[model samples]
Target: MAGIQDHFKRDANGNVYEVDFKYVRNHVPLNWFFEHMLDAKPKPMSGAIRYGVCPNEPACQAASVHSVKVCVKEDSWKCFSCGEHGDVVAAAAFYWRITHREAGLELMRADVDMLKHYIPPKPETAIERDDSALALVLQKVAEASPYPSKDALAYLGGRGISERVAREACERGILITIPNDAFQAKAFLTEVAGKELMERAGLWKPDKKAPACAFRPLWFRSQSHCAAEFRLMREPRDGEKKAMRYGGKSPWIWEGQTPDDYMLVEGPIDCLSAVEMGSKRTIFALPGCENWEPNWFQMMAEKNVLMALDPDKPGYAAVEKLKPVLEAFEAMVGIFNPPNRIGDLNDQLKAMRGLI
Candidate 1:
C-alpha cells in the first residue's frame, strides 16, 4: 500500500526532505539498503559505517570503490565520488535515476525487517595502543642540534632558501639540518633518548668510522594536532651522497583550523615556499602523486581547495591522477600552476630572486 505519496516531496536544493521521512529512516538501517536495494557487498563492517563505490559513478561501480559512505543510521548517505548526497530515499533515487517517490516505493517493497530488527553490538574493552611509534622519535630528532654555522647558512643560500626562513624554521624545529659537528647531534639525541632510539629513528648510523648523518624526514605533530608534517633539510655530505633519502608518515599539513580552502603542493619544502610567499591557506604536501588518502578529508567536506602542484610533467600527471581522490572529498579545487612554469613553487620563488 506504501507508494510514492507516502514519503514527502523535494526541497529547494532538489534533495528529498529529511523531516518527512523521519519515521522510515529511523526504522530502516543503512545496511538494509546495501543488502536489499543495491545488492552491493560492503567489506565486513565493524563500526557504524558501510563504505563502497558511489552507485552514481560509473568508474566506482567497477574498481577501487571507497567513495561512498553509508552511515549506520539510515537517515543519510553521501557519495564522495560524484558529490551526490541524500537521505536514504534520495540516495536510492540518485542511484536509480528515478523520482524520489519511486525510490520510496521501492524501499517500501524491500524487506525492511531484516535491518529494522538488528541491534548494535556491544563495545569491546579498551586497551593501551600506540600504532605509529614516531612521537618520541620526533622529540629526539627535535632535540638534535641544527647546523647554524656559516657553512649551513651558505648551503641554504646556495639552494635559494633564504637565511631568514631557515633561521625561523630552525628555531621552531620546522627546518633543521644535521649538526655539522656530528658529536653534538649524538649528544643531543642521546640526552633525550638512548643511542638505540636514535638508531631506531635513523638520526645517523656509523659507517666507515664516521657518523654518517641522515638526510631523512623527522616526523612531528604540528600545532594543529589533526595535521602532521615532516621536514628534510639535511645538508648533503660527500661520502653519504647516495644515502637513502628519508621519509616518514605520508599525511602532513601546515598549521590551521580546517580552513575554507587548502593549498596543495608536491613536497614540504614547496609548502614552506608557499607560506614564505604569504599564503595563509592550509598547505598540504602530498607524500607523492601515487597516494593521498587515509587522512582528514571528513573534516574538510565543505572547503575549497587550490593546488599549486609543480609545473613539470610529473606534477601535471600527479594532478590528473589525483582528480578522483579530490572529487571524493567533494572539494572545489582550483588548479593553480606556478606562473613562471618552474618545476615547483619553491623553484619559482628562487628563480624570481635569480638565486637558482
Candidate 2:
C-alpha cells in the first residue's frame, strides 16, 4: 500500500488488484478519453463489470452499472461512469491509435539494433598495370624504318641542319632515301622543284618499304640498371604521304645513373637539332603534336621537361595539356618560344644558327 496510488486497489497484503476508474478518468481529459481510450460505456454487474453500447452510437448510458467497484481512496466517480481501464501500454495504444507493440516500440528511446539489417556494401575499382599499348605502338613504328635517303637529308638540311649534324644523324642510322629507281627519283625531284633538295632525297612511301631510322637514347641508373628509353623517328614522310611507321621505340629514352636533364621536343629532327646545338642533356621527341600521354609525365617525373614544341596552335595546345601533368609530378616544365616563324625546335635551332 505504501507505493499504491489512490487509483489502485490493493489487498491487505498490499497486492494491487484493479485500477480506480474515477481517478483514471480524472487524470485523462474527457474529450481525449471519449475519442481514444474507451471501447464502450460500462455497466455494474454482480461481481464484475459489463460494457454498455459504445459512445459512438447516438443513444448511450450516462453512467456505468458495473459492480466491479473501481474506486480511488479520494474520489467517488463510478467505475460504471467510463467504459475502459487497463495497463499503461494498452492505454497508450488506445490514446495514440496504434497497436500495443507499436506503442512499446515508440517508447523505446535508444534501440539502434534494427539499423544494421538494411544497408548495402561498397564496390572496388580496377587499375591498368601493363604498358602493352605503348609497346605495340612502338613496334608499329619499328616496322616502318629506312625511308628514302635524299628526301630525309633534304628535309634535315632545309631545317638548317649542319653537315656535321647531318653526318651524325646518318651515323645514328637515321633513315635516308634516294629514289630506289631513277624514274621514281626524277618524279620526286620534279614534284619538289625549286627547293634546295638533299643530294640523296629520301622518299617515305606509305608502302611498308619506305626507308626510315630510329635513334634510341638509353639512360641507365647503374651500369646494369636501364631506367628509361627514348625513341626518335627521323625523316618522316610529308603530311600527305603514307609512310611506314618508323622512328619509334627501338631507340627509346634511357634514364642514366647521372641525373641528366632533357628537352622534350615535338619531332625527332628537333631532338637532333638540340644535340647538334650542344645540349648535353638528352632530347626525346614525341611522335607528333598530339601523341603526348600522361605516362610521359610519369616517366620524366624527376627530370626537367622543356617543352620545345612547334610555335603553332597544335603545339600550344599540346603544351597547355602537358603543363599541369608535369607540375603534378614535381617536374620543372619550360616553354620555349622561338624568335622566328619556325614550327619546331629544329626550325628554331636552324634559324638561330644552332643556339638554344
Candidate 3:
C-alpha cells in the first residue's frame, strides 16, 4: 500500500519550510488522495463535488455508517457521520497525523499531479469607470436640482451643523438633499442623467424606477465626486423596510494631504462633522464601516492614522481588521471611540453643541 509512511516520515523538528495552505489546497484535489493513496472511490454527487463513505475506517468506522462528502470545486470535505470536516491540507493532516503546516509542505513536495508552481487565480477584470457620466450627473444636480431646501437645512441644523456651514457645504457640492416627492426625484434623475446612465451608475435598480436619491440626503465624497452616499433621515413608512445607508456603484474614499498624519472616520457626514468642529488634520472618510478596502493601506504606509469609526461592534471589528494591515505597512495606528459614551462622530458633534 502506498501509505503516508512510504512517501515520508513525520518531521520532529520545526525546521520545515512553511507553505501557504491556500496555495496547497488550491493545487491539490481532495479526491486525489482518496483515489491514489487510499484507493477508495468517491461517487460523484449532483453538485460540483462527490461524496462517499469516510476513508478513516480504522479510527471511527464512519465509512460504513455515513457519507463523506467532498467538494472538489472548493477543495473541501466533511464526513457527516464522524464530524470530520476540513480543506485539502486539513484532510492530508488528518490522514498523516501531522500538523497542518507539515501537510502543506509535504503536499508541496509530493510527486502527485499537484502543480509545482501555484498560479493565483486571475483577478476579476475591473470595469472601466464612467467618470464623464458621473461628472455630468453631479454637475446637473448642482446646476438644476433645487436641493438643500428649508427642510434639508433644518435637518442639518438639527444635527448641529450651523446654517451657514450647511449652506456653504451645499454650495460646495458636498451636501445635496433629494426631494421627498418620489415622482419629482425620479423625474429629475431621469432628465439629468437619463435612466440608462442611472442604472449603469448604480443609482437606480433595474427592476425599480425610483432613483436612489429619492427622499434622502446625498453626500458626495470630498475626494472624488465619482460616488455619492444616501442616508434616510426619517422612519420607514408602515410595512416598509429600508436600509439606513447605501451608495452608488463606485466606492468612495476621501483624499487628504496632511503627510504622515490623518483621521479616518465612517461616512461623509461624520467627516463633515469633524471638519465643521475645526478638526485640522486631514480626514479619510469611508462610505461606511464595512467599506474599508485593502488597497487603502497603500496610502497610509508609514503614516500616523487615527481611526474614529462608529463606537459599536462592527466599528471595533473593522478597526481590528485594519490595524494589522496598517501596521504591516509600518503605519502608526490609534483608535478613538466616540467620547462621552456616544455612538459616532456625528453624535459627538451633536453632544458638543448640546443637541443630544
Q: Best lDDT goes to which candidate? A: 3
lDDT of 1 by residue, 1-356 (tens): 35434554568986656334555555555555655567655543323444564546553342233222433333566543333566777766777888776666566555545665655333223222232333455545555645344656675576566777667666655554544455665555456556555454443353323323423333334432222343334633422222222334354466544578787786556766777767778877665544466354554565778878766545677677766667787888789854456667777778766887
lDDT of 1: 0.55
Looking at model 3, residue 54 earns an lDDT score of: 48
Q: Is candidate 1 or candidate 2 better by TM-score?
A: 1
lDDT of 3: 0.63
Which model, 2 or 3, shows the larger TM-score? 3
lDDT scores in order? 0.55, 0.43, 0.63
1 versus 3: better lDDT goes to: 3
Stretch of 10 with least lDDT, candidate 3: 238-247
| TM-score of each candidate structure, all chains considered together | 0.50, 0.39, 0.56
Overlapping backbone residue pairs in candidate 3 total 0
Best by TM-score: 3
Residue-wise C-alpha lDDT for candidate 2, range 1-356, written one tens digit per residue: 23225445569999655555443333433322322345433333223333333322222233223222232111212222233345434445555667755544333321234222323111122122123432332232323332334544555566666666555543444433334344554444334431122112221223323222112211111111111133222432222111223222222242323464767775555666777667766666665656556766576686787777776645777788878888898888887664455656665666676533
Per-prediction count of colliding residue pairs? 1, 49, 0
Which is better, 2 or 3, measured by lDDT? 3
